[model samples]
Target chain A: MLAGFELIKIAFVGGLISLDSTVFGQFMLSRPIVAGPVIGWLCGDIKTGLLIGAMIELLWVGVVPVGVGVPPDSAIVCIVATAIAANKVPDAAAIAIIFSVPLGVIFKRLDIAHRKWNRVFLPVVENGIENGRYHILTFVIWLGVFLSFIKSFLFLFICVFLFNAILSYILPFIISAPALVKGLQVFMFVLPVLGLASFLASFVK
Target chain B: MKNCNIIRTFFRSLLLQAVWNFERMQNVGFLYSIMPCLKEIYVTDENRLKNAAMRHFDFFNTHPYIANTIIALTLVLENETVAPTGLPSVAASEETKSQQIKSLKLHLGGPIAALGDTFFWARIKPFCGLIAAGYVFIRGFNNIGYFLIPSLIFIFLYNMPHIFFRFFGFWLGLKYKTDVVKIISNFKIQKISEIIRLAGIFVCIFVLIAYIVSSGKYRFAGVLVFLASFILIKKNVSIISVFWGLVIGCVGAGFLM
Candidate 1:
């Protein structure tokens, strides 16, 4: 139910945030803490953004990209959830968080696919260096950045559009039902403790 | 003149993982950054230049931020190859010089990675994030400018230590050479990590209390679920499972209430 202009704005902001994952400086701009609020600010809903951002930040605090493991793309989750909530979809924030958690795994697979595709270009880079065609190196680096931007743009556009459509249908019933509304409120309140516990668990080892 | 090249190399370090590949991790970006320096040093010897480029194509991966120091150190060592007056006589031979540089990179790789991971990932990042999260939690949901405060706090707090360590690491490596590890040991990063961890616990407790007090009808159940989550996490349960478990428990409790 988001306006066309709103969707475009989300896609643009999503692409900028995605750069933090790999393309540009891995400045923690992509962290849910930062990305969520930025998306919320862009949508003019800072409260929802802060709430979702803090929850997702704590939830995935332990999922840092160390060595070779490609953890789920939490940034995408933040964007999707905040976009849904910001648009005033009832119970959309809770539902988005629940559903988007798995979406991260799918985006992570896409990330691994990109890394694999980069490998396909390695021999070309090596050959270019051997032949003194150093320009190929620059081409390959920019190609990686371009591909990352495309991936983020497409993923954000599709998830925001699709989830908003689905929530538009289901939100009315969930909003009207008193039990469901109270349950969701309680669930959101208690969720942060889980995030805090996950964070503390990291220090345990 | 040499200072400009060092500064250029520092900027290139930021892009060190742009062309990361499964084969060599950061080898391509690493080669790209050092290529200019190699070109300058081996200008008269094309084969040596090609050999130098080939030498760096081997596997290499480390914390990108900390790699600045390694790159600076490698530049110093590579420069010694072309101008050998300052280096020890034992390191004078071309073969020995390359070996020393390669071994130095290999030797520094693991320890620097551990240090970077512990300092950045474990301590600085989480500390900054917790500070922001705690700020938002204390402010409550209605504060109109809530998002701005945490965003600013996160960026400033996180970057302060990150930028400082980056410059300090590079300077220490350039000035003291192999004695950089000794300099790093003197920083007592572990103690800093411990203090941050303790502070993080206090913030989490404060937020948990806030949530409990805010819960009207579900106060008792909320306390129970929080205690259960703490015990479950302490028992080494997977985070995802514990999360879903708590969600289901909360919803089920809501139905009963």
Candidate 2:
């Protein structure tokens, strides 16, 4: 588990990065490439962050949030993975990357749920507009933004805390297995090709 | 004053998905961004303002970056309809004018979404990401400054086109009106997208060769993994499955070796 200060710092940075997911700015700050390094830098390991970020970014390059569908939440995955790797646990980066993919899918589902919840406010927004209560518009907008921040903060907090605890126990075992470690290193080195292939696959017509 | 409103709308457009909902997607945010223009156009007419607001409260979903063109075009249309002095007006009746605006949105939304998705998401984003990835692969990610370079490059490259599209799209919308699509088509995004894809593939191949040659051990395995992955992708395998399969295969191969 992260110490109190580290937890606070990660949560704060995670919350800020999460804003890029939707609330404030869609500035590519939320992109795994940027988010991974930023969080990695915060945790004192820029290389791992870049590696993980590039891997995830390439893998999901084809998955764009075009319409109503939310793509997997790559930012959260980047954050969790970078944080784990930054903790300096052997093989933790691989483990984090392996596990974080499913976590991102879970977050995508949560994002859909949040969007559905936002629907309930539509009537209130319409009523406010109809009644000339324009303040309600601002209220609804801020409320949505606030909820997004809270979701990101809580999600990052719990994931980082749990993953840290799990890694602290399992990493020692993984470190003892040189072959497994070599496999992970090889997988990490080759993973970007998959991202590149997936990216190029989009152009295959 | 008119330019100021357009500028304000552009800034507001940056937050166009702040209040996104499942029902209308970006409708509220879209309405919010255009509200300034509506207010300016329908000043002292609450009913007209209410009608304009209500008109925009319907469904809207588009790539947020590309939505700038739609917003700009909508503003231009609204201006011509409400003011109707210099620009060639579509129709005289308010109802017809509103209907025209609505149809304009309907017509533009899908095309813009497609164009934006193709240009920004598929081509530009991936191209920038691959360039950055290539950088990281070529120059090992040991130095913090070196790692930072790719992230910076990715952001700068991606956002340059994004900001340009936002500004140029709005300017074109204001100037050419509906003929903006013609202007867009002339840019030949398809050709550019193809070129970027080719470059990305080259970079990927370069990085793969570099990785294999430098390591001196995983050459055969790397080649096998690449061929296998290419086939899997060709067979329409899901990325997640392909990813896990590759990892498992690597581990299994590691054990055998």
Candidate 3:
């Protein structure tokens, strides 16, 4: 539903959110739970965002970046997947988490490329800083933001379309099975406690 | 005899606390111990005060526990009122020397910080976390903060002895550097650090297994499994594992439960 200029703004926001995970930001926004819901709410469905946020939060509870150990694609997992679920299945928490995993890995690769490109751009960045051309620095930062936004929007746009197609194909199968429904619900319940244990253990020295 | 104002000394100690950084370890402790005296007696330039502040900027940023005691001793030594008024004596008595030594240990902040960071924050703190995780797994999350008590208790017991011994070790390291090396050749204290690291690893493995087993096959199992595998298979792990694991796990649990 987003228009041309609007897409650019969304992409900029996504880039800012993604960049925060690294430097010049608190890194708090990088976490999937917080990032996912915030992005979802921006797109207009807080409830769906919350559901997906909560689901992603638990499954990825143990994933924390410390000393160069980047986990699977946390940003995309939350941003793109939540956008899809929020725009589509009002209650698609489990499905979003399952689909997000592979995409998270893909995003990690893209992030590596981003880091490498930053190195290539380092000379320009330094020259800008030295020459007092602050606009150049801003441009570099905006470029990262724009690229991240494009990646997020394109990824999410495709996913939303694909998810719609697949669900249309599979909703009938899911509706026919009461046991699968019950099993899925039960599985969702047990995930968080495991999360607590894992989370608690992280602060151990 | 009277003494230098306690307030001045206390405030200087507080300043040292602010600037303390852990990078050079105990160097700041030694430097800050003398800073109060430096400020009171020597560095009289007002501009130097600002420069000294900048030069010793390490004090503002490092660990506080170690720097304070060092600052405390410098103030104690610098109190002109506490100086003996009589003519310079040739030799001090054994009793006076022992008293001076006792006062030095009490006033010096370095040993305390070193001990506090190592024993309390490092070793016993993790044990407390381990115990807390055990209790939460056994009892529940309604009152998990209660587990903090044992950790506090552990801190007191562990920290006190650690400080006491570290003071002793600092003296011994100085006094017996040659003799100690002769006695225990090639004995780098870092070896002890490695041992502690190994212990931490063992503790990590134990807690991880416990967490997985207790969690069972919850919907977030995929996330949990992925993290565990990431650590085990990739031979790398960090704080990220815990954050993602919790986010994914909590949301799933909320949905299912």
Candidate 4:
């Protein structure tokens, strides 16, 4: 029954958490297991949160940011999906990850655009440094953090209210096999070990 | 350029300098180092240097190490005078013409990019990523504040030598430009590269064995499949392919386990 500023605070935390996936955070720290379940637990649903995180973590296991290949943002996937699903369907973690993929991609594109905007700031940053406007870097990072928090909060608030209102009435209309859902659930728990092993194997030599 | 022309070109290039900045890859620090050089070499001349500098920028984003070498060489080639330090300059030779400099720029662009991608991006980066991932896995991700220290250590361990190699290559390239063909001819693909590759593989095998031993629940089929995938990735398979394959494989294994 959280609402208003409290809701906004959690959503803002989600935003800040998501930022860890790119800059200013350990890329691994943004992985779903940590981000999703933690947020889910905060909102009062551990199983849903863990399930959602595990599912997203596996599917995006290959999405490593190597060279210029910017990986999709899983933080948004975990945050928005966990926040909404925890409040709505208590066991909707699997569905949340599946649904979050598109949102994750959208956020990734925004991230790309953000990078493009960052270009204009480089010279400003350089001039600031040269002229002893040493606070510019701090100003820029905080600006980014504030903007990120606002963006995340708005996205989560809108997504949760709209999706919950619609899905509450419509989920029954859409039918899915229980076996398929079970299989996905099973897949979720198993994939991370495989991912960790494969990732480890890359450095075997 | 003649002495006066060289001075003019330098000043002109300084004025015309355009900083190539981008946000992707977080390589702002790397790009910053080259900006002063860019100003000295490219900015001033609209007709002559601008096109080349822009081209360099396009490739620079894709391949930083190699672009650095080629640009450094270009600066040396453009500025180094045949005349003694203070001697009166003779009229310019055909080689000193701006057109020839432009032509040289075009010729070297592709080779340098290729070299940079191969040496820095292709070889070094993956090695570093793998090492870092391994380090983290072994050390664990607890006490999240300390995570940066490990990552920074990994980066320094990987990239510090690379920085040296880049400078070494550039300085060597300038001094021994004439002996390039002879040096390359003497370069043995097997002698050093294979030795290093073999050592790396041996260490990889040792780690694999150790991990398997430590993992009491390890299955041969799972390990074998993982090894196969590892080799495929080592042989340059698409990363996404290896990833999804393992995902499906693990999911199936989960049913059996």
Candidate 5:
């Protein structure tokens, strides 16, 4: 039950997280194992953050952008899941995490779209180079960084709100049943198992 | 180039994918990085300056951190273009010189990118993650410091090697120019990655055992689930499908038992 301003703050942090993911220093502040717990600690639940972050980190440990291929973003999965689970009970986290998993691919598609739109700047850049306005290159670079921040800010804000509502509706049904509760308990171990599997698979000759 | 200009370019290289486009992935960023040097070199000739800018603006992509090596190499080549010595000390046209630089980037970008992908993206990162994960499993999650220490170490591991390459690698390229490739290859980056991967496999197995041990009553099921997921993942199943399938299966198993 976070306040509106609180959501804005977390989403603001999410935007900053987006910068390090790509299109910037890429210091990997956006990596799940880092950003997840940061967001979780921010939400007053460091354990949930660490748990979710580790899960996502292990699960997608094999995915790296090789050449032109963009891997699904593990950072977003952990961010959304940690935020959701930390703010609520741990029981609902498994489903929230699973549901948020698609966000990695969804963000990848948006990344592709944003990159596609970047073509419009080529003309502007070309014009600048011809006219000797080299400062425009710096401007465009900063503008790209700024736009990336805005996109992730809006994306996370909407996702946190939207997923909260959806999870609230769906979680009660799953949580109320004893069997489902048992399932949720075991579901905790499933992520690491799957995650480790992916890691081993990547190493397979 | 002035020390100040080199410093500026070094910082600018961090945004090497700032305006990445489908048409030319890192073209704008590449231009942006070398712009200061180009300006100083071609100050007297506006035409050369524009040509230089436009030349770098062509399609260019490489690992962002390791790009300093290429940028330094390009700076040397670009300087040579304006100098009478040229690349081979044989008379070469400006067009030929500029074309040479273009092909240099195009040719080197792929190999360096592959090396970077393996070295940083695949090997070092996973190795760091496993270490942090192993700590988490061993320490459990009783205190915030448990998470903080591992996270700090993980970030520290990644940044130490890369930041060194990003800043100092420029000198490697500057000193060697065309021979930078040979110098880079001398490091046997692929072999290092293989060693890192071997270490990562061991850390991963340790983490797995810790996780199962931590599961208490669910240890047997955890082993079963691990085997099933491992087999499926090894057999080429998409992770997300395997994830949801196992989630449903776990929930069902819990319900059935």
Candidate 6:
């Protein structure tokens, strides 16, 4: 398991990774396959990162950010889950993934809110143009990127803490229960298939 | 356009969605990317520049990469209407010329966005991701440090086309001007994506077979899970729910047995 200090650093990288989606680069750095393994290595558990990242990537394989459609924030799943699961037992990683998946959905809401909040910048630009302060454009654009960084940072920091606490509490019971362990392990193995199903569906649509 | 401004606009275009808002979606970024050229176009008349800037602040959205082409088209159109050097151009029909640019932008933004959505977002991006994911799933890296091989593959492959298109697309826009659309259509971007997508489908199936073969005891479950998800997604069930439901079911079923 990573230390408290280490978790903070991963959260910072997580913030930058989140930016690649729509905020700036669209570099696919935020993709689970990429972010997962990277964060995994950061946590000193490469296999765990690769495992979680590959599964999440396949799950959303066909999903694209067409128009205003916001896909699930799979990057969140990769970063948080891999960070939490790294070096822990394999079963614990599976548990981490289960909880972390929902966090992506939660982050999506914040993402929408951030975009809505960005409306404030538009009027600022209008004012800048009217007042002939062109430098304001550069300032506001960077500000948008900066604020997006902040949002992802805060989200990752909070999620890592809350999920760590919850998984810590529940993991003992699940480990003790043979049935639950077997079940989660099975889910881990099969999750990729579900991803393929969706991948195929994306083609059909 | 000066090479410096072209380069500047090309870099700025990367920030296309930085301040995206529902009200006017990419208008800010679009205006910002072309700001350098606008400065040059309206250098003599601050008022004209201001109007042009204000006009762009209105509603706008498009696929970010394809937008380079449109932005280039605007540069050509705006340059054409500008009176060369000292001529104080006719003010009456100038409104119509600017209006033509506006209409052109409005018309191009939506359709090109859809086309780009299909070409880049739908096919190209995923093909890169699929290949990378396929590598990870199949290769099963022995060295932890080697994990990045897939990531690097994805980055280099995707960016090769991405950079080429962003820069070249803009150049084509400048060269062809209004006829750039015809040039773009001639490329058959959608056709290329279709082929890439087919390749992706094969990669996907290949990965699935590898997973099933490796699963051993879980092979039957893997097959079942695959079919169940395909059907659910086909019926339009949301992925988040399907995922969460599967998690809960697996945990609960463990208890039931």
Question: Model 6 off-target regions past 4 Å?
Answer: B85-89, B141-145
Off by over 4 Å in 4: A1-205, B1-62, B80-96, B138-149, B169-192, B227-237, B255-257
Model 6: how far residue B173 lies from native, Å = 1.1
Q: Residue by residue across B84-187, what tens digits does model 1's lDDT show?
A: 45545633487788988898888887788777877787777776777777677667767645457788889888888778777777777778887777878888
Candidate 3 chain B lowest-lDDT run of ten = B17-26
Steric overlap count per candidate:
0, 0, 52, 6, 0, 0
Candidate 4's DockQ is: 0.12
Q: What is the C-alpha lDDT of each candidate?
A: 0.77, 0.80, 0.46, 0.50, 0.84, 0.84
Instruction: Provide fnat values for all models in the order shown.
Output: 0.46, 0.57, 0.01, 0.10, 0.74, 0.71
lDDT of 4: 0.50
DockQ of each: 0.58, 0.63, 0.04, 0.12, 0.76, 0.70
For candidate 6, the lDDT comes to 0.84
Model 5, range A1-205, lDDT digits (tens) per residue? 7679878988999888878877889888888889888998898987888888877887788676788888888877778888788867778778778889999899989988999999999999999989989899989999999998898889889998888778877877877788988888888766777778778778755
Kindly list the per-residue Cα lDDT of model 4 for residues B1-257, writing each as its tens digit.
Answer: 22443333332221111222354233342233334444455445443333333323332333444334444455555545232345344334423543454555556555544554444433344344444444433343343344244345444755574555445545555567535424433655235444544554554455445544545544465366556766776676765566456546654554555
- Arranged by DockQ with the best first, the candidates are 5, 6, 2, 1, 4, 3
Is candidate 1 or 2 superior in TM-score?
Answer: 2
TM-score of chain A of 2: 0.93
How do all the candidates rank in terms of TM-score, highest first? Answer: 5, 6, 2, 1, 4, 3
lDDT score at residue B66, model 3, on the 0-100 scale: 38
Task: Please give the TM-score that candidate 2 achieves against the real structure.
Answer: 0.93
Candidate 3 structure quality by residue, lDDT tens digits, B1-257: 01353343333332231111123222232333344454554344554333332333232222233333334433343333234446465134323533553455444334444444554344443443343334333343344343233324433544454454434443343345324324222444346545654665575456456555665554256445545644542444443454455446544554565
* Candidate 1 Cα errors over 4 Å, as ranges: B84-92, B144-146
Model 3, residue B220: distance off in Å is: 16
Greater DockQ among 3 and 4 belongs to 4
Model 2 DockQ class: medium
